[model samples]
Each structure stands twice: as structure tokens, then as C-alpha cells.
Target: MEDITIHEFDFALINEFFTELERQGPGSPEETIRALGFIGNLSNKTKIADLGCGTGFQTMVLAQNTEAAITALDLCAGSIDKLNATAGKLGLQNRVKGIVGSMDNLPFQNEEFDLIWSEGAIASIGFEKGLNHWKRFLKKDGYIAVTYESWYTDERPAEIEKWWLDAVPEIGTIAHNISIMQKAGYIPVAAFTLPESCWIDNYFVPQKARQEEFLKQHAGNKTVEDMIAFMRHEADLYSKYKQYYGYVFYIGKKM
Candidate 1:
């Protein structure tokens, strides 16, 4: 058995996840952008860098909603390829430039962007590393908007606890996320709790359904077994941790 991080699992299943997003409806990405403080500030003066911008859904939305030029990046070449293809089709190729790279080490000049945006990707390298590593890319007074899971209470369900221990092993709860950001010289601007329904409707239930359908269609395939394993793991996590686990959208400015 190969040891894989949650980020790797997510990258491998990006296509299915995007399908789930589409099925879940529009507000998913829209709410994410709004939470990131991009809703009202999309203007020509802003230059945005979207790290781990898988498939460019938010990249396209940012380009359309805001006049800012966006440099969308991801570690996965497949994701960048998909994002570029989609951008070309949408005629947004000019506004959004796709880059293939790692988030741990960004390929940009210091203080290059007015805003750094990450949705569901900061945890790939851990929140503290993300805060410290990405800070140099933001100009003085620039902001970063990130979303990560936050703990609602001290009580954690066993399955959820087990998954994190097995997978990430080192991530802190939401309170730790806030402390990490502040300690890294970012002033907390805005924070919001993501509704639990978003996870159930957008990730858990849809992923379960998709895995089931795939298994039905491709019975006895070895690949189906892997897919089923991933889905079952996710379902177990959500079932046990739904109450204590939630996402927090944090907006912080360089101090």
C-alpha cells in the first residue's frame, strides 16, 4: 500500500469532485469567493494569485466578476491543463494565466500580488506553512483569503479523529489556524463559519453517490475498489465528525 496525503487523494479525484460541485449548484464557488473578500473588490487595480486553483472555476469567476488579472496555479499538471482548456473555451484565457507549480514554494517575485486566494488547498501543506510561505508574495497591506476546517467544539467523533490522525496527523483545529495566521503577522479581517450543509450536500453525499454509480457501471474492476475505499473513508469521516467539524473562511491582511 502506498502512503498518500489527503492532497494527493484530492488531486487524484479532482474530476469527480468538480462533477459534484456542478451538481451541487452555483452558490458553491460564489460563496467561496465572497468569503474570500473578492466579491466587491474585483477591479483593474487588483492582481490576484489563486494557489491550487483546480479547474479554474473560481479563476473564471474572479476574472468575470472582478477586473483584476489572475495568475492561477496548481501543483497538478492535469489540473492546469484542464484550467487552461476551460479558460480558452470561455474566452477568459487572456485574463487568467495558468501556472503549474507547488504552493509550498510559489514562483513569483516578492510582493507581486494584491491578493492571494486559496480555497480548500492551504491544508495541503498545512495552514502555518501556507501563511508563512505565501506572505512574501503579497504586497504590503495585501490580503489572503483561505478556507480550512475549524472545530466547533472540543468533542471529536472517532472516525473523524481517526481519519485526520491517519491522513494529515499534524493539523490543528480552527483556533490554531487563527493563532497561526496572527503570529505570522497577518491581521484578521473577516472570519465566517461555513454551514455543515455545504459539506453534506457538496462533498459527502455526492461523492458517495458517484462512487456507488461507478461501481455499478464498472463492476469487478480493480479501479473501482480504490474508488470505493476512498469514498467509504470520506463517508465515515463525515458521519462521525459532521457536528464538530466545519469550515472557516478567513481573510487576513499583511501587517
Candidate 2:
């Protein structure tokens, strides 16, 4: 049993832990649809890129709502395979295709997508960098929609602020984020904070059963215990300081 930080855990272990859940992070289908409403003119001909699509939860939601062809990309092979299988079962295999790849190095042509969608995954690459880099893949007037952790107010409690800042140094106030998006060559369209239900009900609540099963299977594994403990701490932090910060959906049109 060795003491280690969450980041020190093997990537494969982390991916495996998340693959059992429908969502790797805080979000819901309702929030996904709400974000989509800001973007218009979608049709069968429209192409969408869903970067960091963990198991394609939101991707499936997108598929159900629109006729757009979606390329759901993620770094985890297991997640991609599961996503593809789920797509097939849901009869969305024709429109929703999952590929395993890094978000920063997308395998697509310039100006290829009508929409770029990412939920709870932009932090892997900094938000500003993701927006700037992904812009090349979007057609003119194309929309980019993403959910990133952002501060709800100008100031927050020191404990929560330090915790989040330590984890994601690039985190900023919603206004600051919008300004960054504008500077990165986009017209910020709509910005909204996901409600607490998305975190408490849609995200954390669903993990309980899976967490218990995971712990039972990995009984006596220190790393597994450490990972679950870390996740529980994150949930506690969110519950305690949810009023100060949460995931915010930012929508922008490529300028």
C-alpha cells in the first residue's frame, strides 16, 4: 500500500473506473439539449466533433436530438468501444461514430465540422487553447459548445478556491472565460451554469452502486481505495462550495 496522489494513479485504472459509469463527469441530457438550443441550422449534412466524449453519454443525447453526423473522440479505448456498442444498440450507429484519440491532436481536416462539442473534458487541454485549436476544425459560423469548471462569483472561500486552483490552475470566473473565448476568435453566444442536480443527482448519485461493486472487486487494493477516496473528497468539496463554482456551459460561434 503506497500513498499516492490521484494523478499518480495509472491512466488505465482511472479509465476503467469511469467506464462503468454513464458519465465521467457532472452533466445531464437536459443540460446537453439546453446547450444545443443556442446553436441553429443543424441538419443531416452537418458534421459534429465531440471531443473527450467519455463513453458517449452526451454524444448519444446529441445524436437523439439532431440528424448531424457526430465523431465522438476520446483517449480511452474501452470508453470508445463501449460508446460504439451503445450507439449500435440505440440504432444511432449510423450517425454517432466513436474514435479513440487525444483532443489536442484531432484527426480531422480544417474547417470540417459544423459543431464542436465537449462536455467536462476541456481541462485536459487548457480551455483557451482548446477553443483556439479546435477553431480550425469548425466551418465559418460553426458553433463550439463545451462545459468547463468556472467560478460563479468574483470571490470564493479560500479552501475551495485553493483546492480547485491546485487541480485546474487555468480555472477562472465565467466572465474571464467568456473574454478568453472572445479573444480566441469567437463570438460568445450563451453561457449558463449547470444546476446542482446535474452534479448531485445525475453524476454522483449514479456512482454509488458502481463504486461499491468496484471496491468489492478490488478488495484490499490500496490504489483502488485511494482513488475512490479522492473522488469522495471531490464530491464533498462540490457539496460544500457548490454555490461558489460549478460547471458552466459556454457556447460560441467561430468568427
Candidate 3:
């Protein structure tokens, strides 16, 4: 038999990974809605594109709170399916559309949307590239809002920096986020850091508990073993880089 790859992990396992991440409070969908609300009113029935809209949690929020017509995109087919199902259940099917696609190569015409939103996904692609690539999709004077992992202080520990470099080699330091937006022809409108407690309470503990339960159920399954290994590698990096780090939400207007 050929060696199975990490990408070959069952959809259930991947779903478990993200579902657990969503259960934590403060980082929940409600929090995202409130955060974006702080930037400006979303009542204009604007056309919006949500890139990397995992499972459509934030996308649904935007749909509910704003009169905006939303197009939600994700790379994972399963996630896109769940998003669509949720949208239908919420009666937002007409207002929001889901697409399974890549952020690097958006499948939309130039100036297609009045606003673009992303959360916890741009790091998977390079931040600068993601910002630059998606900018063209925004209409002139349109807004782009994104949440990225960033450090709170100007001084960062070497180990923490190394961990980020190794794990997410593409994202530059937190200090560079604003500058990246500016260089991409976006005028920075607002910026704020999410609390570290959000991650600890929401992502780390719940995911760890879920993984433990899975281990008990699956026993010696090889796929389970691979999942455990991959998760531990990521957790180790997280711990090493566990300082006063959080997501920085940047709201920008296209120039």
C-alpha cells in the first residue's frame, strides 16, 4: 500500500479539528460580529466576499447583521458543504453563496465586491500575498477586514519567533501587518488585537479534550496515530510561541 499523506486524513477528523476550535467563547462567531461592528456600520446591503470563510460562521454573522450580499469561499469542500447547509437552515441561502476555491487565485472579476472579510485563514497563505491578491476584488473605496495572528509587544522572544517562522513561515511579524495593508493600496481604518485568553479558552483546551476522547475511541488506528502526531507537532509550536500573542483585526479602505 502507498503511504497515506496528512491531507488524506478523514473528513470527520478535519471537521473535529475546526468544530472544536469554534466551541471556545470570545473567539466565537458572536465575537467576530461585535468586532467588525466596531469598525463601521454594515447596513448598506453591500456586496461582500468572505475569503477563507471556514464553515461560514463569520459569513453567517455578516449575512444576518448586514444587508450585504455575501459570497463565502473556502478551500475545503466539506467545509463549503457545511456552510451551505447552515446558510439554508438559517434562511440565508438567498443572501449568501458558498464556493470552494483558493484565496491565492480568486475566481471573481475585478471590483466585484464592496467589502472583503477574512479570519484566521490568511496565515495559511502568505499574508502579504493574500492581501495583495484579494485587493483587486474590491471596488474603489471598498473595505477589507482581516484577522491575523500577531504579537502584542514590539519585543518578541527568539523561540516564539522561531516557532512562528517554522510553523507559518509565510506571515511576517505582527508589526508588519499595517504596513502590508498600506503598501497594498489600502488605507488602514482601524486595528486592534484580540485577547490571548480567546485562544486558550476557545481553541487549545477544547481541541485537546476532543483529541483525548478520539484516542480513547480509536485505540491503535494508524490514522488516529497520524492525527495525534500532527496535532502534537502543532501544539508544541503553539506552546513555544505562547506569549502575549493574538489576532490583529485590520480594517482598511481601498485607495
Best by TM-score: 2
Better of 1 and 2 by lDDT: 2
Quote model 1's TM-score. 0.83
State the weakest 10-residue window (summed lDDT) of model 2: 1-10
Ordered by lDDT, highest first, the candidates read 2, 3, 1
Off by over 4 Å in 1: 1-27, 38-42, 212-224
Residue 203 lDDT in model 3? 64
Deviation in angstroms for 55 in model 1? 1.0
- In candidate 1, what are the lDDT values of residues 11-124, reduced to their tens digit? 455455453343322125656656655333456888999997876777787777777889998876776887888889988887889999889988899999989988777776
lDDT of each residue in 1-255, candidate 2, tens digit only:
123335667798899889999899999999999999999899999999999999999999999999999999999999999999999999999999999899999899999999999999998789999999999999999999999999999989998888887777899999999999999999999999999999999889898888899899999998888888877888888889999999999999999
What's each prediction's TM-score?
Answer: 0.83, 0.96, 0.83
- Itemize residue pairs with steric clashes in candidate 1: none
**For candidate 2, what is the total of clashing residue pairs?**
0
lDDT (0 to 1) per candidate: 0.73, 0.92, 0.76
* Candidate 2, superposed: residue stretches over 4 Å from native: 1-6
The C-alpha stretches of model 3 lying farther than 4 A from their native spots are: 1-16, 19-26, 38-41, 216-218, 221-223, 229-241
Task: Put down candidate 3 lDDT per residue, 48-83, tens digits, no spaces.
Answer: 999888788788888888888899998877788888
